[model samples]
Target: MAAGQHFFGPWDYVVLVIVLLISASIGVYYRFTGGKQKTMQEYLLADKNMSIIPVAFSLMASFMSAITLLGVSSENYTFGIQFIVINISYGIFTPVAAYLYLPVFFKLQATSAYEYLERRFGKASRLAASLSYTLQMTLYMGVVLYAPALALEALTGISKVAAILSVGLVCTFYSTIGGMKAVLITDVFQSLLMFAAVFSVIIYAVIDKGSFDEIWNIAERGNRTDLLNFNPDPTERHSWFSLIIGGGITFLSLYAVNQTQVQRYLTVKDLKRAQTALWLNWPILTCLSLSTSFSGLAIYSKYAACDPVKAKVINSPDQLMPLYVVDTMGDIPGLSGLFVAGIFSASLSTVSAAVNSLAAVTIEDYYKPLYKSIFGKSLSEKTIAIQSKLIALLFGLLCLAVAFLAQFLGGVLQASLTIFGVVGGPLLALFTLGMFTTTANEKGSLFGLLCGISFALWMAFGNPKPPLPALPVTTEGCSSVFTNVTVVAEPQLTRATTQQQEYFWLYKVSYLYNGVFGLLSTYIIGYVASLVINKIKGVSTQNLDPHLFITPIARRLERTMDIPLNTKELSDSQEELNGKYEVNGKY
Candidate 1:
């Protein structure tokens, strides 16, 4: 690897430091001024008075970060235009979350969405989900820090280990001190920079090549023909069926039930704003995914034929995006700075969000319950926040520690993503079954979640090299990176491919599929266990009230289902509902 003198220019460092100081300054001001909000409602939901536009965009921006920026783009670089199809998941599944889970969550108006699992199924179900979510989120938060750190590590000579502390510390400061208001508001700025970084890469890519069409032709040559094959083959990796069904379930679980996302929905001033935010998130994410993918395409056009891997500096496709920036645009004073701005932008917003949300969950779900159990139901927000911040610090340190786990392994983006999905699969099912089906009682929910998680570990990461089938890649005219470059896996391109191959069977299990598997098992096992537990524990599925689970649209469709909608009795939950809500109406 060729190494050179590396430094961020004075102007660039100034911009970076100024960004950090500005965020910290706002944190200090808000800590005193608008920071009077110390109640659980204030900390977790922002007093539920946030304007719709910023709230919705915050949700979009928070959800869309370096993870998606690097993730989908890397997928595209490695997989081709095939990765573009994730938009289908974001577009359809997000609104599905709005309709399916939002109705119950809003109706219950619980601070933590997992609270419903306890109320509806039982405490065991909630514990199962909460513990799993904490695990999922901790690892996820680590990646949030870890991913952008990869970008900075490649850019600056700083070790990946040190980059994490720098990123984690600043984010922890804002998130711990500023709370959700700080997180959502600052996220707006981060989102803007996030787009700037992506679009800047695009602009630089276009400037170097002249026109989009010219770049497309160059990129098309490096494309894999099989990448675009969208057959519903059971064994194919990332097939259309897997992308839609598997991706849909994962999105549904993650967006609908996860406290991190639910916490964002609470920031909306009213349900109306929540609804608006929910509706807006789909297309915004869809567009963001496409933009990142194009950024990868840009990287491919410049280096795919040369097969930069052949050059040895960038052995993996994931590194190609960052390397392209350094090689092509780094000479400009802040171009490297701009990319880092984008990187930190993406990392900082999400990391702060994680810290705040984790604090919320710890206080409400875990700490509060323990407090009540140990003493009584009366714990002040001040006490909870202090405990929560301490948890946040510990959580931050744990995430920082986990970030190093990936460094030992080679830079493989898909492996990281799939590892997350495999573990998260079971948790997704617990929430899905709790909200979707009345038959899944507490016992069933717990059993199903455990079963689903156990199975996922066995399937996705159980074996070394994973006996799963490989997707095809087009490399007919591909030059060996130095001829010493090892050929590991075949590639695939989208439709209009120049080559073809049979789909592999074992690949029926993509990471996304884990969500479906978990959701299904939770339902199936939940019902069976309900009977056994009902006998032993004297439980009652008989009282599984349809009213608790129905949606606004379901009210309109109730006539056909024989479930009567009483407008008068809706008053019981009305006081909980704000006049500003986003629902169609509770029947």
Candidate 2:
């Protein structure tokens, strides 16, 4: 902590302020530019004509929030680099999102992802899924907004309230005023800062340790460099099986079908560009993920001899990276500021995405439908456009309030990610059931979603689960400068307690597998329930849109199942064919 203990310097403050001003300026720039964001389409989907690069970056930035920057590093620092294996899952699941799920949403051209559910199953299913997504993003954004604030508090002596407000309000301003176009463009900028922030830690650590290999060697000696584990046990944390299979499903949940990303995909002019953007996201996301994981080991190398938590230097692992930056790099003007700005950018990119996507969902799923049902007609697009901004503002505020409560939710990485798994798995399952299976009915999908969420929540929070073990650390190397400070011995879970746990088996399963449990439970239960419901009610499963299902499955179903393709429902015009009917011809 002696390297540079003065916190943010004048240059650092300038860098941080400049970043915020620029982010806000982008929104104001787009507010008065082309189309002026007055139409719902322009406001939410960037008029459906955005470029591939920005859209690609936006897709990556949407979920790769401050949580990833802080949590992943802490995860690596405390646990090990085995978590990096999740990056491979991102690459493996990219096509599943691009080919299997993206095409359905792209062809449908729905503003909200859940709208496809209405077309495929029924309105009830659409509403159910939309509600689930709203809850998921709300909880996730709370953690996103809170992470940087926590860091700023730890590093700069700023109150968490001030830190949260400074970042959250700026994000809300740009997101509400600039709309999706602003979000996409700002995401590209913010994503670079995110990279710069992570690289600062790695570069500093490498310089301090004298080489990158030395960092890895130190991590290896500390038992933090193991990247391959073939254990089949789901309860064994960080196994290859859990990181791949479980992480892959989590990737598909976010990229393939999440409204935040699917909306970004639709910003492009054609499906080809959108898919290209999605494919490009894989590398960008993996690059950041792998870099962040290494940054953890980088920070670990700094404190390998004297553990921070054991020495009472920091209260939590989430504070490690920020503490490392201020302790080691703060003497250099604007360096710590650049890192803080990067952290802020991560939170801004993610929160803005959530704000926009949640607004889209609110309008398309709840507001419009409820209005139509009550007023017996739809509102004008101009009115809806105005309301959309207001909705975005309100959601932004809601997330800000939730950020205050996120401290109670445990570690940012696991808590934010668990929110995805608990909600994402079933939502992915619901969509897959409709798109992949011909027999899935609306009632059955809803039933399975409810059941899946209930079980996943129970698994996540039902019992007093055993604490996860971390690599051993020693405070013996701590100097006499703090001899008065008592060093508490890190707790040990002996074999007696480790071997006989009273917690439920499901509760003991790795958090990585929470989504898998939800996905499997929902898919299996929904499929079986659909069969029973369809059988009892004699529900007709014919005259369905072939384009509504996944391309390969729809083609197979049409070839063998004798179900009508419903081509006449779509017009004979080439624009309609290309826009909506995918199975008829490729995009």
Candidate 3:
């Protein structure tokens, strides 16, 4: 585990080069063979004709970044299988997204998910949601880029900055040129690569570590297999309630409101296919989580005697998977390269999806409207398509710049969930209020969104004090026969802090609950404010647009209040409403 001790050899370099070159070549292929991306729809949505399988795989690729691959294993190694609660959360929420959220966007034929905000509320609401999403993705992309770069730097002795730039440039190239089509195509390949790379490690670990019983014995004895913790404490990081409820809210924010995911849903040609694609993601993601979690146990079994952290072989838990791969697979030539390539694949897929979605939102939500207002004319399809490419390039560079900042952040899993809670939570709340209720008005939503964001930020970053670090564990169970050399332990220093261990009440809330708090805060505030405004202004709820609410909500209101819910009339009215906004270039 010394510096450059298990660096990639020549064949490994060949494998890595092949993976990068194939990704770039996909971009070239789409640029030349797919014809010109003359319209925003073509560039951003792949003309909405994408098939179910590729889109499903692309969703998997986007969802399972290097952080999931590396961080999940690290988590299992450190905390046991309780992290599987996240997958359970996904299982519960993906259907909610498909049934409740997907139809609204699909029915509107909206280019941007935030566009529905404009149609339902006003331009200000749309801008608020879109800006929040753009910021979230931009920040998350940095962590996505940084994770693989850090891993590769350890595995192949490549400079971390170089690894980040290589991924950034390649993803940007294909994504800018080929747009969503190339991104999805490459994602399919990357997903397969990820499966291969992970399974190879698992297969090798099984062979090296003996039968499943032995590995399970080692892991169970080390307290790595505990799956269910029903602790009800809100402050506890991983509990059944936190993981189920908090994790459900977190996943809902991603699958329902996040632009990266919505963009994938919009790529398909029909609602049925889109729903099918979403269903496909569950099993794929579940398998991946189980595989990596098992890999963690295998890693624990392999290193049962000599704890790398205690031995000073690695600085953090995130580095454990890479260390294990290098130690176990170093003699297998191109295997290390494939593993690095797999990490890069995960990073590239996630970043490319972010870049493409960011560009789409920039044009559809911001640029197109501004250009029309100032110039008093719409830009041609060709010009808009070109602008989209430039926007992708710009955002890709921005991601690289911010990636340098991620090195100072905490573990990848916690950092990413915190970002989701801080940004995605408020965004999800705004959309939920708009889509589920007819009473929420523009002024109310705007106020609620601002307040939600401020509160979430306080919860995420208001604490100035760091928690005490846990004590390191010994590797006494690891067989002495594996290592005969005497290893010296370095003295560890502890810091005693007399500063009062006080924190703002909000700061003590687990990051897992940020989304639920933000969602409820925004909706309740917005709904109440709208009721007051309606009472003062004497506005009639009966006269409001029914399409502003979800189908079930609208139907329930019709039953309860005897309000006539005319489906055809509502469809026509919504079409006309969006048409009016589109004509003004404010859609």
Sorted on lDDT, highest at the top, how do the candidates line up?
A: 2, 3, 1
Off by over 4 Å in 2: 2-6, 480-501, 557-587
Q: What C-alpha lDDT do the candidate models reach, one value each?
A: 0.66, 0.84, 0.78
Better of 2 and 3 by lDDT: 2
Ranking by TM-score: 2, 3, 1
CA RMSD (A), model 3: 3.4
Kindly give the stretch of ten consecutive residues in candidate 2 with the minimal lDDT sum: 578-587
Clash counts for the predictions, in order: 19, 0, 2
- In the order shown, the candidates' Cα RMSDs to the true structure are 6.4, 3.9, 3.4
Error of 3 at 442 (Å): 1.3
Top-TM-score candidate index = 2
The TM-score of candidate 1 is: 0.86
TM-score, candidate number 3? 0.92
| Residue lDDT tens for model 3, 258-284 | 788888888887778889999998898
Give per-residue CA lDDT, model 1, range 1-587, as digits (tens).
Answer: 13233446776677777776765665566566664557767766777777766666677776557777666666666666676676687777777778677766766677777887776666666776777777877777777777777777667757777888888776666676776776677777777777887887789879988988877876677553234567776455677778777777667766777788888887765455677788887777777778888887787666665555544455355556666677676677867776777778667777777777777777777888888999977687788767777787777777777777755433344544555566556776676666565456665668877887777666655434333332233333345422334445546766867555443333335666665666666567766776666567764444343445646434544444443445344446454333322221111
